[model samples]
Target: MSPFAKLLLVYDGSAEAQAALERCAQLSLALSAQVDVISVVDAESANAHCAGLLSDLAFHRLEELARSTLDHAVRQLTGDGIVASGYVSFGRLNDVVLRHTQAFNPDLVVVGHRAQARRSRWWGSRSAHHELTERLGGTTIVTVTLPGT
Candidate 1:
């Protein structure tokens, strides 16, 4: 049996995300695994006053974009003959991914992360990738890094 029967991919349409998608495709083919792709829309409002109608509109637009991004990723994987499905989620990156992890119970979680310079990291702050990996705990994670990153 394949070590990883199910895989979850976190995609955001960035170059790094594209790299992750490609890695997932490779893994799926090698392991004969099913993949679930997810794209998250940051629905948190930046301004407290931007509520009611404005917030709703902003959220809707974000959701639409997320859906489009996810659709494209899924299409690419399916076209490659991989069994893949995708959906859009709303919330912080780590939170959304963690929730999906719980529901999907994937054997492996794949994510794309761009490396940052040591000076670029702020004091007492962690990158989103770090937070996600930590939150996932025991789940095996495969991080795909972009070239020249």
Candidate 2:
């Protein structure tokens, strides 16, 4: 039996995420693992950055974008003859992902990691991939990194 029976993929429609999706598809086929894909809408950050009315509009748009991104990912996987599930949520990236990770209890978590800029890294906030790896003790985390565009 394959060691990984279930897989969770964190996708955000980025080029890095597309690469991860491709990688996840290959892994799923090889292991015959069940796959769950997720995209998060950070509505809290949107509200904090925008004014009242603007915040509402931005949050709505963010949700729409997240939903579409996740749907497209699921469709792509399905087209490849892989049965997968998709989820869209609003919250901090790592938090939302962790919540789903707990619920899904995947044997493996696959996420695309784009290295943050020096300025952002200097701020001391870790990337979602970093946080997820730390928070998910014992669960195998596979991070696919892509060079900056």
TM-score of each: 0.89, 0.90
Model 1 ranges off by over 4 Å: 45-54, 117-119
Error of 2 at 39 (Å): 1.1
Across residues 1-149, which tens digit of lDDT does each residue of candidate 2 receive? Answer: 89888899999999899989999999999998879999988877766676544555666788899999999999999888888999887789889878997888999899988878899989996888777888888888889877554
lDDT of 2 at 20: 93
The best candidate by TM-score is 2
TM-score for model 1? 0.89
What is the lDDT, from 0 to 100, of the residue 93 in candidate 2?
84
Local distance difference test, candidate 2: 0.87
Please, what are the lDDT tens digits per residue for candidate 1 over residues 72-118?
99999999999999988877888998999999899999999887777
